[model samples]
Target chain A: MSERLHDRTRLRPPAPASIGDRVEDVGSPALLVDLDAFDHNLAQMQGLADAGGVALRPHAKAHKSVAVAQRQIAAGAVGICCQKLSEAYPFAAFGIADIHISNEFVGADKLAMAVELARHVNLSICVDDVRQVAAMASAAEAGGVRITVLPEVDVGHGRCGVNSTEALSRLADAIGEAPSLRFGGLQAYHGGAQHLPVWVQRRQAAQRAAEAVDGYVRHLDARGVSCPVITGGGTGTAEFDCQSGVYTEVQPGTYLFLDGHYGASEWLGQFRPRHSLFLSATVMSTARPGVVVCDVGLKSVAVDSGLPRLWSRDRSGWLRYVAANDEHGVLEVLNGDSQALLGSKLLLVPGHCDPTANLHAQFVCLREGRVVGLWEVDARGLSR
Target chain B: MSERLHDRTRLRPPAPASIGDRVEDVGSPALLVDLDAFDHNLAQMQGLADAGGVALRPHAKAHKSVAVAQRQIAAGAVGICCQKLSEAYPFAAFGIADIHISNEFVGADKLAMAVELARHVNLSICVDDVRQVAAMASAAEAGGVRITVLPEVDVGHGRCGVNSTEALSRLADAIGEAPSLRFGGLQAYHGGAQHLPVWVQRRQAAQRAAEAVDGYVRHLDARGVSCPVITGGGTGTAEFDCQSGVYTEVQPGTYLFLDGHYGASEWLGQFRPRHSLFLSATVMSTARPGVVVCDVGLKSVAVDSGLPRLWSRDRSGWLRYVAANDEHGVLEVLNGDSQALLGSKLLLVPGHCDPTANLHAQFVCLREGRVVGLWEVDARGLSR
Candidate 1:
């Protein structure tokens, strides 16, 4: 084996950017975080959360940066929520005091990792299955750590969690009995509702999710389980969640780094975030008559939601990103000036923020076309 | 800033795997490379290339592992073609002598990096623009190194490269006149043809690409520019490229690690690689009755092509990977034993191989369900 391949930690470096360099000089195909816009988004979400009297636990799963998470907490987030336990490691290692694995921890290895991580931070995890609860309880007991266990109530996403109040009651009862585990209320996240383009559709989904949380809180209360927290709301449904009157905490992640996918949504149009995440790709090939090819492609940005918007140009209405190869984005002229030079940088607003953020090694945090810092995507590839 | 966040090198690790560990004990959401099948694939591709009298340069953009690239070179591969210049660094640093950037290198930073890299290894880059040729010639001359240049020709993809023979001759004449560059050959890569579902469609596309290459090679030859090599083709079009009698070398990446997307295609069905790349996620939540939520989703696997197929069991046709959130793959039962327990390890054949491989930090190379070695995705995040 090659020695370089054997030891795996040396990541690809801070490409095309020094500490004092201008933004135009920063590397193509970079995950550019407009720190100015990010701060604005942070303040706006915090203000909304505060006005509604809900504690903001900004989901770190969107950006997965220790810096961003810390900033969110500094801006009055009660804590940060991670979608995976392993995803919370770098954050906890960086002294992120409180961390919650908003999603369930399944499997022995992962459960053990969660228990191990609990020793370092104020940790809480969601559980929907009795087996998951049992495994967590065992790991917590073995590790001699008291970890909070949130019983997940399936609040219309229909992906995971307990469906009925009876199921919630059973899981909550199991959690309450565990000496090493504390019952930490309900994990009632309406992920499906978070992306419904229609405002009314999203509101109704949030309402359904809220009702499920309310029904479970009532059920658990009657069964002598004090439900003090109900956490679940994303960038799309945070408004409804904060005003729901039941959720003590709302987890809104993508609001900070809103992308083209969320930007097009009428549901999230009210917040009107200044698209923080941008992919600045170099126009590598201008060989074709009226077309210029960009260096960013599917590998540079996530396309699960949709293609990134041409953020640098006002001709986006008709200037088409026709196709994308592994490392090339083909820009064709439909009506506008598509004659970009061979090395000009074109800003791309990522389609989806979270997965796109996870693809990059570091976020080129910029302010006014100048490099402020390079924030490591500390929890990138931490899917576990 | 936290010291850990700034340095950004020490990655998440449980590296250096021990043999004989059970598959269930492996970490959740891991990129598992079946070594047994991988070796078989190596032999198969070598044999196929040998029979066709064509060289195989397995695309490193698929795995980005120096170990895999070295293995390919050892097993009769000409070299490895990386999609990015920086991506080829770790491989070059690891003593894999020859590397090619299959994609265009734009921007002053990237071109300079490419020239600097040439001092260490045999470097070649593909370009279609005259300005790209001019810049590269200047860089090579200034650096006192000779770098090979492949003038890319658009076959049918229409993503990048020049179309006309007149343009090709112009770029070739520029390379021919340059003191620091060698006109290597044509980069007639039919990226579109590589993923066409039908065998006939792929063959036709390859034929068109071959004719275009022949036209360009003849055009260059008539102008006194010797064209010795022709490189292109991928897993889907490897057979067609090898048999085309025009391509001197074929670049097949995903053949070594076949995924669900390639498996569904009739083109690659003949060479069904033993789903080498597998994602084993824990059944984190099985509380939704018929639904089992695996803690592997868009973050773990690339959904650009399609959802992953349930691989550990034979019921993949019925056990549907219904939905995927940021960190959850919801597996539902259309018909089959979908009652996976909380800790049951379910294997997944990823949708697309390239981006899916890019998503993970390391590949847990497994032999007969036993942990072998941890292969680092060495060149990951080198998008620049």
Candidate 2:
């Protein structure tokens, strides 16, 4: 312990790289993505979808980049599922065809933007109200494009979507009446199920959601209306979604870059993807004997899930992200005998991936610990 | 309650702006700041600093806008406090003369960036260790620039900083020894106190932090050394900071845009400045009897503090942001008759203002329901 304290872990050794040094050469709190791991995760999801006879519509909201979406499509994804139209705008602009806004949009202005996007790409959107259908119709008419409509049905989680079949039919009928809109299917997603943590809890929740969708589909069929599609699923419950056999397409994101939170589970899966997001912070101060302060903080990383886990430490010291500031991260030397020397670089696996991805402008994509590519988070900060 | 719903509160109605409405004119979810109220908050803080005979170094992390910084400086702020060197890059790039990065910086690459930044702006950065001091000095020598250094001290928030005056003095001595470094004062910010909700808790926390600074200052005085600047205070404890006689400058950022979380508090003499951040999300679907789904969801508005409160709505309907998809917000309309009609526009006050502000690219600054200016969130997505 005395020897470890003498060799502080938080102080990263001087990584003296010239300005021309590739992005990867600049070490940890850097985000590292193993391309092999990423491709395996992608292929596994695709294979699962193909085996289940379902279309893979990967959600781009998890990884809000056109580059990542293009890769998903290359891996046989039917299209992309975007949570917001603003998020879809950039993807659509990048020629990501068959975009489904898996959320409801209400106002005329946003509807117009969606319609405008539909003109350039194949667009499908979800709605939980008749008025939203009318607004979409008007906007699509103005934009001279036909938009596919999915009536969002609440399958639990108590968020958005129609609570009952009656409300779903009403919204569907409203869509049928709109000249510029076509009934796509149904969006039956229970978002709360994604973070169940326990495999049994997650599976049960997905089964319950599927049961709700089954009821909705049967109700529509009884009324002589065929619901062509049922799109919903996430990384946390994609396997359960496929097993349920109710959802026609799964919108699983974050599988490409499994974060610390998702990785914490003991679920059996072959897709061990790499983390692509990082808050490359430097150790700024080490005045305290047992602690080291870093340049990254609350602003640098999203701590809603939990603190970042110390990734890739070569020393005896187990570094912990004990606290954070808007611009500083606190690393505590938990083990006195640990050798995480001062100025020694260390990787941190973020707790939650999505919010962490949203916190950056560009992803410094790496391969074999070398700077291979850099993709701009095109839809980042497009909150409108 | 029924009468209140029909009372037609004096809040501005959603303005129907066309697509041609130059980036500014659109209504709902737009943050409207009473500039007069803002100026008053600025002056009040400055007056306290003047009366207390202390330096007023406002934290720029709250506003993150160059324009706002100019206003703060105009109201008598000596210098601005930033959390990161990168966060301060934009302010420095825009020619905001003086800056103090209230956190430590460690990596050589980042140190070089700071050194590069110091070439233009008058910069002071915090340090918690000797190795970091060496790195900063190396970067400074490489860039041929001098940097002011402040040793971060741990008062509370066990996050970062040193606990001993001996360690602080040692780091200060190390900083002074550096060819391109100058020893500044101390940074004793109690981060945990910022969200105490209760004013007394916040005050008591600040008092303890002040006591730490007093210890350091007395030590410095005994050594025949004069510590000029002692910076650290946030929006929550800024009032108590002015009263404490310890903090030379108080860094409060959230006062410009009081969000639901901050405004929900009943702190004495605490002024409610104008709400300056909004997520201009459109209602996407409203088919359900008592629910409205919006285009903005977890991707658009952050729920780190909690879900955003529906702004300008009457108590007739208790609006709860019950769910969030990537692009959809599920607002549960509870109690009485739901006042939210289909396609009706609504404003939402975010739980935490900073992350929400960081989520947007532009600020549609409004006055009396009319767009006056469009400020780009320049430092937004600068998470790296």
Candidate 3:
């Protein structure tokens, strides 16, 4: 029993890969980031944001890594956007001065978090209702901190935010009335419009969203209210949004790690999204002919957008991720040798980067086919 | 700057709920387990396994909580099955002396974990290939641990395991040759058949799997190899698997907390699976007339099986979770009041329990509409 207790004490799960280890030696089902491609993506997005004259506030909800956010800030991002109050904790702790909660949140607990976060950073949060404003203002006052309040306007997303100008005005008025709150700007984001697949459809969606934002801005202007910053735009529609002249700041999270869904989209714009993130999965089973099962599945990668695409250097398309169970990803070997593939590590570009990144505890930072570092997905599962 | 640093030091995300908080007062997008229903589920599964005369080894992959596993152990579960080596860490650390890795794994890292775990616990792992056997044997021998090897046979679960008795015999021989290995019987599981929806179909599938197991056992018997345990079953087929008389032990994970997918299935069996688990989501947005968005989405719940069903006490079907974004669940109000739902906490029955449970850090344990305790999701993202 003493030995058993000692053994238990010594049992620690091995890290996916040590620093300087080759990519092939990394453990299966690891979240991997190609540092070269990541750097390229960072420079590219920064360049685009610079040329377009828009403040880049890359959403940290996609990576949830302080390292990634720090790199983004170093590359000239004005701030970072987090979808939840808890998600912004790590970035706040890491001393990222500006963080925005890009989604609506309620409850005293969330308000308390917002207030707490406001004390450390230039914390901003979105709200679509007057009740939320009152609660947030009360918490901010109680905590002796001022919070930037953005009234999210439904710019054709139809998910969250006020659709009507009256509702928007009410929220803006409420924020303006609160002494501890500053009416920062409008959160006019059309999340659904970001992934229309076709370039023309996405452009049209962005145009409609821009028009809606213009209307909301004009309405506020008519009421002698100056909208300081209009924050809303994702990886898909950032190019068009920057050209819209309506959004002062853009939040493009997936731009850093272009996923299978984004890669499938027609990118006629200047923003070149290279696939930087990958699920390093090993071909665990090759019992059946023409089929191999990898160690990645629903737990390792998100299938909300679609099954991950097998990332091949030559775009061979020999192996296709056919299905995903809890801990197994079934891949159909179209023309490759399944036997030879056994025990070999394969890179999978996830369907959705945000949720897929949220699945892993850390990202194996890879450079020149070797692990350079491991970055903790610090705010992972911080959905509250 | 010092004040900011001090504030950052104090910035910690609050717990979802305190020990004595009311159910409604708990934070949004929290994983909740109804203790009453959970206890009922525990007793029911135990009763089912007891009556069937089969040892119950509940799968911990569904609820990776040590507290839940402890409860299961106290309630009569022989052991627990974790899919990944890393996932079994907390349970083993918490003094779970018996554990089974019910899936095949590769890599030196995983083998090392297997050997290390074997030292403290009765660690049994599944394998389909002879190559895996040699590596595992070497690791176990070097670690000075006797690791039980279960040769997984593909009983219609085409994902993993050997299809033929010849291959199975080869694996068994490989285990027999290994000094630090024990041939612990077969892992004949059909994961795809678990959610067949129809009872007769599931029963037929279970029977076919039983026949397959029986054939494999006979092949081993012909070689004078005694198969002490034949373990393979899940919530959907536990009833039929136990009755098969072929399986000495049945592994059912989801029976303790039935998800929407399992709850939707036609259960004509004696095992009464109850809905114990829930995703506590708050209606954060009610801007649209008929549509309200909750704070639970891809980050909070798994939508791989299907979108989460709104769990209402009255079963009025007033609201339907139609779509899920990264952090938002769009619920369409069907003949109900959207305004009334705003700021109200709604219970969501996840589409799938395993992956959904993987998303949260802790489960807000509830008893009679009050928060009783908070159980950490010990192995929340230990996919590696």
Candidate 4:
């Protein structure tokens, strides 16, 4: 056990960047996380959580870095929430004592591994079905370990979980009665609602989610069960989740590193949190008169929400980014002054942060354009 | 240097599987490469290359695995092509003597690194302008190294490269005159034409690309410059490229792992090469009657080409994949006793293989449903 623990400790080494080196000197298409921006966003989210008197279990699935997770833990966050057993085990093995898998795990082997990991930490697994509950219970019983289980209630997303509070009650009751399982309140996440793009829509969605979760908590309370925690919120509706009055905990992932899609929100615009994450691509081609080719493509950043916004100065409005092949992004140069020559550096703000981070092995942590640190994305590729 | 080398060796430990463990026993949403199918595709592409008498430089950016590149090298492939300097360095370091960067690289540090890396292997980089030529020449001269250079010609793809043969001739002249560079011919890749969806359109696009490339080659040849190696083709246009007499070599990246987009081609439909790659997801939610949630999401796979197709049998057409949040994918069941309960597994064929493969750290190589090998994506995050 000591040997396995020691081996896992050195999972990722630091990236190729020395302190005080410029961001352009690091590498092309490298994931850059501005430390100043990250710290500001972290404090902002923590402040919101504190004001509501709720625990902050920021989703570790966003950055997938132990360094970021530890920073959150240091800043009054109770724990971190991972999305898979693979992600949860690494945190547990890395000595993170409190870890909750905000998603579900299936298969006997996966559940068994989750149960084994639970023996090392305060582990909570989510389930929306009696079958998943029974599997978790069986795995826990087999491992001779008690596991915390959460019943997910689908608020707005028709993707998973019980649609109603009544259905959630049955799953919660089953979890409470399971032989080796302890009921951990709820996983009431409105995933689709988080990207609604409108302030009122997102707030209303969070309000509805909170109300539905409270209804389930009431149902469980009347049946002699107590709700200890309720965690479900994302970067989009973090404020609404906090102000909803019933949520004891709000899980907001993407708050530390805002993407263009989430950053477009009016609420987020008011505070003006820095764009913490960026993809630094190089101008790979400048043969054409009015177009330039960049190195960041679909392989380096996600385009699900939209094409990445050009974050480079002096060329912002003059360059239009068009998603091309897997290895290239074409930027149309609108003016003569916007001459993006070969070897010139261009920074891109990813359309979505989570998947963009997943494309990188480590973050080139910068401070004012200088490389100050390197954070290994320890849980990267942690999707089971 | 040895210490850093040792640390890099341990970057990724063996994935959770021995030689004979079942696929389900491994992990959910893990990248799986069926070895038998992979071998078949490798041989199939090799056979085409042999028949056409053109060298096959299978683009390593598809799998990013040294294992896959080595197998290609073993199977009559002359070399491998990478899209970035960072991607090429790992292959060269892993003992691939011949490596080509199919795209232009920018930034001084990156160029210097490429020059340094070239000292250990046969490195060839692409350029489409005189500025890139001067930069490469300066770097190579400073490093006291001789490097191979390719001038890219834009063949109907307005993304990158010189648009006309006149421009290509000028660039070729510059490459041939560079102090520390050897003019290695042209990169005529029409990326836009690779996914025309229609057979005749794809073929015509390839023909047009070849005609334009030949015209440029003739232009260079007329000026007493030798076009030694003309390289460019892709999984979507491999046959068309081989049949075209102008291209001395073809770079086909995705042939070994046919995704749904490329696999939908009528020409590819003829031979029916095995779908070598897959994303295995677990049924995380079974609460809703007609829908089930899987662990694979936007982070686990790319949705740029289209949503992934359900590859598992008995429920293939019954389940329609709907992309949800970063952590979940919803599958709607159409009909029948295709009961996908929690813990039950489903296999998905990615819409596009390259970007999806980029999301994974390692490929869980399987044969007959059992783990056979673990291939670390040596250049997975080498997108610098």
Can you write out model 2's per-residue Cα lDDT over A289-319, one digit (the tens) per residue? 6777665666657777788877665432566
Give the range of the ten consecutive residues with the poorest summed lDDT in model 1 chain B. B2-11
* CAPRI docking class of candidate 2: acceptable
For all predicted structures, in order, the TM-scores are 0.95, 0.87, 0.96, 0.94
Residue A173, model 4, lDDT: 75
Compose the digit string of candidate 1's lDDT tens values, residues A1-384. Answer: 323434233323335576677888888888888888988899988988998899999999899898888788788998999888778878877778798888877666676777777877889988887877888888889999999989888788777778887777778878888999998888888778888889888888888888878988887778777887888889999988889998999998899988888888884434666788898888887777778888888888888888877886665766577666667788876764554567877788888999988988888888888887888898888887
- Candidate achieving the largest lDDT: 3
Native contacts recovered, each model:
0.57, 0.38, 0.60, 0.52
DockQ, all candidates in order? 0.52, 0.26, 0.49, 0.42
Tell me the whole-model lDDT of each prediction, alpha carbons only.
Answer: 0.82, 0.71, 0.89, 0.80
lDDT of 4 by residue, B1-384 (tens): 001111211222235566788987777678888888888988988888888899999999898887788888989999999887777766776677898888887777677767767887799988887888888898899999999999888888776788877777778778778879999988889988888888888888988889988888888878888889999988878887887888989899888988988878767432346788998888777777877788889888888999998987767867888765677888887885424466677889999998888888778888898998888777777776
Instruction: Summing lDDT over every window of 10 consecutive residues in candidate 3 chain A, give the lowest-scoring window.
Output: A1-10
Q: Which tens-of-lDDT digit does each residue in A1-384 have in candidate 3?
A: 001223346566788889999988989899989989999989988888888899999999999988888889989999999999999998898789999899898888888888888878898999988999999888888899999999999888777888888898899899999999999999988888888999999999999999999999999999999899998999999999888888999999998999999999999888877899998898888989999888998999998888998887652468888999889998998986787777878888999999999988888999899898899888999998
| Model 1 misplaced regions, further than 4 Å | A1-14, A267-272, A336-340, B1-17, B267-272, B336-340
Tell me each candidate's RMSD, in Å, in order. 2.7, 9.1, 2.8, 4.3
Alpha carbon RMSD to native, model 3: 2.8
- Tens digits of per-residue lDDT for model 4 on A286-326? 77788888888888888988899888777787887876568
